[model samples]
Target chain A: MKQLKIIKIGGGIIDDAASLAQFLHLFAQVDGPKILVHGGGKGASEMLRALGIAPQLVNGRRITDAATLDTVTMFYAGKTNKAIVAGLQQNRVNALGLSGADGNVIRAVKRPVREIDYGFVGDLTPAGVDAALLGALLGLGLTPVICAITHDGQGQLLNTNADTIAATVAVALSEKFVVELHYCFEKNGVLLDVNDDNSVIEKINLTSYAELKEAGIIADGMIPKLDNSFDALSQGVSKVIIGHALKINDSLKTVLCLN
Target chain B: MKQLKIIKIGGGIIDDAASLAQFLHLFAQVDGPKILVHGGGKGASEMLRALGIAPQLVNGRRITDAATLDTVTMFYAGKTNKAIVAGLQQNRVNALGLSGADGNVIRAVKRPVREIDYGFVGDLTPAGVDAALLGALLGLGLTPVICAITHDGQGQLLNTNADTIAATVAVALSEKFVVELHYCFEKNGVLLDVNDDNSVIEKINLTSYAELKEAGIIADGMIPKLDNSFDALSQGVSKVIIGHALKINDSLKTVLCLN
Candidate 1:
């Protein structure tokens, strides 16, 4: 059986058709069973603003308030999901779109609040999944496109993070596959210096991650990305790559661990 | 506490924007804790064909073969999921998109093949859901926009059905809130006369369902749908509404039962 690889595309990289097309072109070259997890934070926020709504974020996560939730359901599931599917089809890649709520794929409980409130956010619990279904789709030579929304036991929608979703999926498939998590962005790679483009770090192991954190090299948004990568690695993923969505060849060099 | 409602959007309705926008507009008026679960079957299949890949279905369920699995991950999670989010945002709904792989929301085991080989499909099992997380989100007045995809215990992506997803979610939340399920489509309602537009049934109860089924008034696609609805009702869903997606007001009128 071919090994499986899981890749995550950041909101920054997925905001445009050109970037998405470029990414898909490269992705078509990769071998084995692969899955892509993506974020729509930037687009979703922009759409909200255009609709005269103020977007709210709780700890960097979007708050799916009543109105916002409706917008997201329509936009993410209806528009963005189809655009991606159509894009892949235009590129000659078979793609099927879906959400966690479709098959109780991700059963969630509402997020608990002690001090701050995060509306419609859910924390996931362990539920048995149907791997045979996935294998069957792969066997039929179709690509599965998944969205980052789930449901609680009672069929309520929940907002979930893309990085976490990718990491968890990688862990779940690690035993039978080689999970390769890619964090595609505009940057070349993980930079060692904020100002120097030449300060890209070739690689860093788990042991060295703390040192970088202590040195204040990894902070803010990068923190969650790295944390999610490490989480997947610890859970038996083969590799985690962070690089540019465009220029896949250049990123592939970094991804291949040839740096 | 606001009552919880679970609204399920069908692929037929979500296939186009005009219908989806209208659906979201109505969803915005649901003044309570609500969750949105959506499907992308038709879109996924159409996209797959355009990409030169043939879709495989086993007994009306998608066969998630290796290539199909890859296609769906990209189509469902990356595209359809975001599209829905974007649409909701257009209406000022702060929707966040997600898959089950995030937060381990829904865990499952690799479903063993029975009669036919349906690769990569998953069946749901009982696992604790994080209701507190959802409750917090609802408490904060956020709506959840969910996609139908989940992960197995080993972390592999599993293809699942939208109706089943909605049913399980409804059951999960029944204990804490009033779970109102709306399965929307282009049809006015379940029809007794397949060719007669006026044959729309106002309501269906558990007692009447058998007669309808026996008389062959409920067949084909409606069978599975009604089965799912009844399952939810049996499991304690407060109500199930089946109607046309475009006739929003009329659709809301077919309330099957109220708890």
Candidate 2:
């Protein structure tokens, strides 16, 4: 199988223009057919504040009301995605930006209202990803840069999680390629000591992952992230890497495996 | 040669929700391969007012400053483009939204300044439109929905005119297909009397266009639009149709030919 790397970058890198440029420069050097999935930065909230819309939170969870969804759609799908695409074009990489609505690449269902209404938030599964279209795009020598906006087949746009989108797309494409999912964030790696950035864990298999959870090393936010990573590994993903966005090409990062 | 239609819709139909929906419904029924190019709606100006940006006009021409470029990019490429794509998807058309930066589809140069500088505005030629890529996308059964934002083939995104882009794309694709260009707006067609909607000129050839201009029937703002349409017709476009957006499938329209 051909090797494919799918990298997910969060706001830590994207919010900083210089950092985002440097990351894209490094990403352009990765030698393979790859995909880049980016999360929303702090730009959306800043624009919302400028537009005089207060953050609408219900029971401590942010709600994607109609206005919020519009603001974020403009930010994620419009400004940031185009910026990255233009930058990649300048770097000589043929990058194509995508929202789920474009070509129905990711047909997500709107999250059902249970206790709190999330307005336009989208929920996804592996089946929702269009592997054939993505494969054809890659075959045409175009690297796809995806943003965090998805759509319902009926016409509503929804705000979705970028991490979940990356993992879901990775799982969906793994059947055709040896997929390596990279979660690039602010930290160096899964650190042994949270305060000490240099205390990076080299590798973690299923046994070590269970021990880390048992020993309370993996708790709270990291728990869910690593849990999803392991789940992808079991679902035909060849590997998962967690590291700083700027240090993606560096070897000093945490690697996860099913073994 | 195969037949292809390229339709350009401006703010008249786009600003209204019901009209835009009706137009997309009519557009979905257009036979054979088709492309949709949309202009920025009034929503962008309203958002600018809410965000406290005054319009900057020099010599009666609106200048696209840095802030104005950002706002327009968000509106044209982000919100409006995605909305149209999702709407077309709902109508069972596989629409793929695009900026000129995507796939380097339309590489534009920044407009040079003589008296006043139009910051981040792009100028295009037929050579800039990637006809082969667009043809391949159509071969894949995808309809390209383009917006008025383009890139300088560097890292800068620029605001462009939607009408020009549509004409240039039609001329470029005419090499492989019998290209028909449609300009959809509020009016029924080219009227003999500007005030009479029923006095529509059904067909206009080169000779009739010259006689109409000599009689002062086509003057003012329409001179430039028709001039460009005739230029496209001379450059290989098979036909140019001017009609109302909602009445696209109707027989009440103006057809321009080089004969």
Candidate 3:
């Protein structure tokens, strides 16, 4: 069976160029096919401010109104997307940057809101994800660097969460390939003790993840990350790893199962 | 009949906040159904450089190689797209930003290269333009701000020229609306002499444009602008105006009409 990996770099990992570089180095050496999806949550917010626009978020996702939508497209798709691609190129890795809107690779409908409108946030429909096209790109020896942006049916920008994007891609590509979800952050791994970086959990199954979340040990952003990891696994992905971007190799060894 | 205008701002016009502000002021006063399509050629290139990526342009268009394509999408679709939308919002215009790939609004086939491989550039087919969806947005009292980025059928980034995009859009919407193509620049208008900025020609018809080209007076980038303008007019656009962005009202008097 062919090997495929979907590595998602968190906003924290992307904020640090050094960590991103380290992750890219490991990504370049990895055998088999891989797709890299990244988020520019903080970067995009800062950029919007510099341009004299206030960033807005709705339901943990960026509210991509007309103005905010343009900013996200420019910053996420233009600046951060190019920077990541350039960094990969410097390491002699052939990477292609893409938006979910491009080629309808990720088709979606605007997430309908009841009271406060979420503007252009989209909920992915199964019809929207294109695994065959992505598989072909990987077969051509190219790594796809995807930005977390999508579009509604009527030509609108929708800010998508990168974690969900990675999970969706992993599930879509899992049947024909061994899919591994690498969730890279600044810390070593999912810690058993919140204060201890050395208390890295060697591995996590779906049951442990549920227990941790239920006990409130994993709250906030970590909850979504864990949820998305299990979602991918349930959809047929072979493994899911949550680890530090800089020390990804160690985490990969612990998390990825080949069989 | 509801009058509709397709105002196109060159990437040059929106390079800075001041210029954007000036354009937005003009944009707000235009009371009609309108669509705004913008270019980010220079802005995208500059941001690419900041990220240490050398942008390669073939035939005056960014060659969307794996690296450059990634950068272009981020900059054009994300950064530049948002800045314009934000500027419009700051000026009280509810402008929404969108790309050609949205809802398959603008689809095209990858242009087959003749001399050099223009990696990921697209040639717009008539079937690719989405006028109805755009018309629906205008009918809903929203000005659509479009970025000149599109996707080929195979999920590849296609570097499309802004002028062509504007022209195609004009033609696409011509049946239901009176479409006008406004080509705004820093100069007062197209001048007879290259050295004199004050030598702004008040008006010119298609015949005069041909005469100027025949005399070798029109050269470089101006040639394409005139070509695209004429293409729009010939394809049923009500008129095409070329002038300073701030002098849109004055430029309206010099509109080139086929009739």
Candidate 4:
């Protein structure tokens, strides 16, 4: 199977244009068929404030109202996505920007109201991914830059988590490719000591990941990301890497496997 | 040659949600391979005003600054384009939204600074369009929903004219498909009597268009649109239709031809 790398970039890299461009320049250097999934950065929140839409949260968790959904959709799927696509194009990559609604690529279910209504938020599964179409796009040599906005296939666009999108897409494409999912952020890698960026773990398997969790080194924010990573690994994704966005080509990164 | 319809819609239908939805339903019912090109409606301006970006116009032409470009990119490529695509998907049409940057479908040159400097504005010709890829996309049964945003292939996104993009793509794809370019707006068609909506000139040849201009009926905004239509017709587009967005399936529209 051909090797395919799927990289997801979040707020830390995206909030700054210079860092984002530097990351994209580095990303372009990493060879092979690749897909980029990007998160909604602080720009959306700032824009919301500019638009006078009060931040609505229930029990400290953000809620995506209709207006918030519209704003984020524009920010993620429009400005940031196109900027990244054009940037990649400048690097001589034929990048195609997409919202899930573009090809119905990832049909998600609007998150059902449990304790709090997450209005217009989407929860998706790997089965909802259109792996064949993505494969066809890759075959055409067009790199896809996907935004974190998916549709319910019934005309509603939903805000989604970029990490989950990358992992789900990786799992779905694992059948056709040796999928390696990378979660790129601010730090060097998953740190052995949370305060030291250079305290990289190097590698972590299922047992080590459990030990790390028990040791409380991989707690809080790192927990969900690693859990999502392990979920992908268990479901056929070859490997999951966590590293700095700008240092993607470097050797110092944490690689997770089911081994 | 296989028949293809490339439709362009502007502010009249797009500004109203109910009207835009009605138009999308009408668009889905149009037979054969089709492409939809959309103009930036009042939404961009409203958002800009809300965000305190004062409208900058030099000699009646809107000048796109960096901030304006960002806002418009989000509005057109992100919000409007995705909304249309999702709506079409709801109507059972597999619509793929695109910016000119996507697939590098339309590489444009930033308008040169001369007497008036149009910042971040793209000027493009039919030759700049990637006809083969568009034809391939159409072959895959995907309806392309293009926003009026092009890139300079050097990481710059330019605000382009939707009508021009529509006509240029029509001319470019004419080599592979019998292209019928449709311009949808408020009126039924080119009005024979400026005051009467019922007075639509159903068929317009070049000779009559010249006479209409001489008579002042086809003056102002209609001039550029008709000029673009004839240019497309002369280049290779089989025909150009000017009509109302709602009455797309009806015959109450003006059809422009060379002969």
Candidate 5:
């Protein structure tokens, strides 16, 4: 099987123009087929405020009402996606930006009316991804840059989590490729000490990840992120990498393995 | 040569929900491979107004400064493009939405400041389109839904005119396909009398078009639009159709030939 890298970048890099440019430069240097999945940055929130709509959050997750969905769709799928694609183009990468609605690449179901009613949020499963179409796009020498927007295939667009999108896509494409999922953000890696910049935990297997969580070294917000990474590994992803977006080509990053 | 229909829809239909849905349904039924290029509708202007940015226009053409470019890019490439793609997806068309920056399918040069500084606006030529990539996309059994946003290939997004994008794309693809360029607007073809819905001009050739212009039968804004259609015909586009968006399947329309 061929090798494919699925890289996901969060708001920290996207919100800063210089860091995003540096990341794009490094990404262009990566040799092999890859897909970039990006999250909506703070820009969306700013725009929401500008438009006089205050964002609603429940348990660190956005409560995606219709207006918020519209704003985030514009920011993520529109402005940020286009900017990143144009930057990659300038760096000589033939990048094509996509919302899940494009090509019906990711058909998601609206998170059912649960306790909170997360208005227009989508919950995706591995079965929702169109792996063959993605493979065809990569076969065409195009790197797809996906935004955190998906449709229900019944004509309703939904706000989705970018990390979940990347993981799901990585798992789907694993049938055809040795998929390496990279979660790129502002950190060097999973930190050994919360306040130390150089306290990088280089590698974490499933056992040590449990120990690290039990030891309180990987507590707080990193828990869910690492949980998601391990989930991808268990589902046949070859490896998962966590590192700074600008340091993608460097060896100083955390690597996760199922073992 | 294979037949390819390149359809361009203006703002009027897009501004209305039912009409846009009807147009998409009609578009999905058109046999053979096709591409849809849509203009930035009133949504952008509404957004600009909501954001408290007064839109600037010079002689009916928008002056796309940096802020204006950002808003239009979000509306056209983001919201409108995705809405159309999802709608087509519901109708079972494998629609892939694109900004010109995506796949580097179209690259444009920023309009130079001669008499007017149109800011970040792009002026496209036929040579700027990547016909082979488009052919590859079409070969993949996907319908491309292109928005009127292009890149300068130097990390800048330029607001492009959708009509020119359609015509230029038609000319570009003529090498591989028998291209029929359809300009679908609110009116049912070029009316002999602007007030009468039944005054449809069934067919117009170069000679008759010239005579109509001399006889003042085609005047005002319609003159420039027809000029563009004839120019496209002369440039090797197989034909240009002018019709109401909803009446595309019916024969109550005008067809321009180079004869």
Candidate 6:
């Protein structure tokens, strides 16, 4: 199988122009077929505030009402996505930006209203991915830069978690390629100590992941991220790497495996 | 050559939700491979107002300063483009959206500063378009939804005139497709009597188009549109149609031909 890299960047890097430019410069240098999935950064919130739409949150997750969804869609799928695509073009990378709606690449279901209504949020499953379409795009020598907005295939656009989108796409494409999923953020890597950035775990397998959790080193927010990472490894994704967005080419990162 | 329909929609249809949905349905029902190009409507201006950035205009044309370009890029390529794509997907059209930066499909030059500087605005010729990539996309059975945001291929994104985009793309793809460029707007067609929608001329050949311009019937804003239409026909586009976006399937439209 050919090697393919699926890199996911969070808001921290996207929120800063200098960091994003540095990251894009590094990303353009990455060899082989690659796809970029980006998160909705602070720009959306700022726009929401500017538009007089109050930002709603429940348990650290955004409650994407119609107005909020519209704003985020504009910021993420529109501004940020195009900026990155144009930047890549400057570097000679043929980057095409996408929302899940574009080419129906990712179809997602609106999260059900249980105790809390997530409004227009989408919950995606592996089957919802259109691997063939993505494969065809990659075959076209076009690097897809996907935004976190997906559609229900019935006219409704849903706000999805970018991390899950990256993982799902990586898993879907694993059939044709050795997929390397990179979750790029502000941190160096998955840290062994919360206070020390240099306390990188370096590597964590299923066994060690459990040990880290029991030791409370990988508790709280990093827990869901790691769980998601391990899940991808279990489902045919070659490996999941978490690291700083700017230092993607560097060796200082945490690698997750199912082993 | 295979037949391809390149339809361009201005802000009138895009600004209204129900109208946009209706137009998307009609677009999906059109036969053969197609492409849709859209203009930035009032949404960008509304956003600019929200962001407290006063819009600047010279001779009724926007001065696309850095701030204006940023807002317009978000509105056109991001929000409007995605909405159209998602809507088309609901109609089962399999629409793939693009900005000029995506796949370097439309390489533009920053408009030269002359009497006025239209900051970050792009100027394109037919030769700047990437027809092969578009043909490949069409061959994949995907309909392209293009926004009026193009790149200089060196990093900067420029706000382009949507009508020009429609015409240039039609001219570029004329090599592989018998192209029909449709300029869909709020009106039924170009009115022989400016006040009467029923006064559509139905057909205008090259000679009559000039006479109409001289007679002051097809004057003002319609002049540039018709000029663009005639230019496309001369460049091998099979024809150019001007009509209401919702009434695309109907024959009550002005057809411009070289004959």
- TM-scores for all candidates: the values are 0.53, 0.98, 0.57, 0.98, 0.99, 0.98
Reference-based lDDT, each prediction: 0.65, 0.93, 0.72, 0.93, 0.95, 0.92
**lDDT digits (tens) for residues A98-179 of candidate 5:** 9999999999999999689999999999899999999999999999999999999999999999999999999999999999
lDDT at residue A237 of model 2 (Cα atoms): 94
Which digits, one per residue and each the tens of the lDDT, describe model 4 over residues B1-259? 9999999999778899999999999999999999999998989999999999987877756799999999999999999999999999999999999999999999999999999899999999988899998988887778999999999999999999898899999999999999999999889999988789999999999999999999998999899889989999999999999998999999999999998
A1-259: candidate 4 lDDT, tens digit per residue = 9999999999888999999889989999999999999997889899989999987877645699999999999999998999999999999999999888888899999999987799999999999998998998898888999999999999999999888899999999999999999999889999989889899999999999999999888998889889888999999999999999999999999999999
Q: What's the residue-level lDDT of B256 in candidate 5?
A: 96
lDDT of 1 by residue, A2-85 (tens): 577666777776778677767877876766677766766477776577657899876666777866775565555544555565
Q: Pick the winner on DockQ between candidates 1 and 3.
A: 3
> What level of docking quality does candidate 4 show?
high
Those runs of model 2 whose alpha carbons end farther than 4 Å from true positions after fitting are A58-61
- Candidate 6 stretches with Cα past 4 Å from truth are none
Q: What residue runs in model 5 are displaced by over 4 Å at the alpha carbon?
A: none
Question: After superposition, which runs of candidate 3 have C-alpha atoms over 4 Å from their true positions?
Answer: A1-259, B214-221, B251-253
Better of 1 and 6 by lDDT: 6
- Scored by lDDT, the top model is 5
Local accuracy of candidate 3 as per-residue lDDT tens digits, A156-198: 5578878778888888888679888887777877777789888
Q: What docking class should model 5 receive?
A: high
Clashes by residue pair, model 6: A78-B78
Candidate 6 residue lDDT tens string, B99-178 = 98999999999989998888888999989999999999999999999999999988899999998999999999999999
**CA RMSD, predictions in order:** 14.7, 1.2, 11.3, 1.3, 0.8, 1.3
Q: What local lDDT does model 6 show for residue A102?
A: 94
Who is ahead in DockQ, 1 or 2? 2
Which of 2 and 4 is the better model by DockQ? 4
Error of 1 at A237 (Å): 30
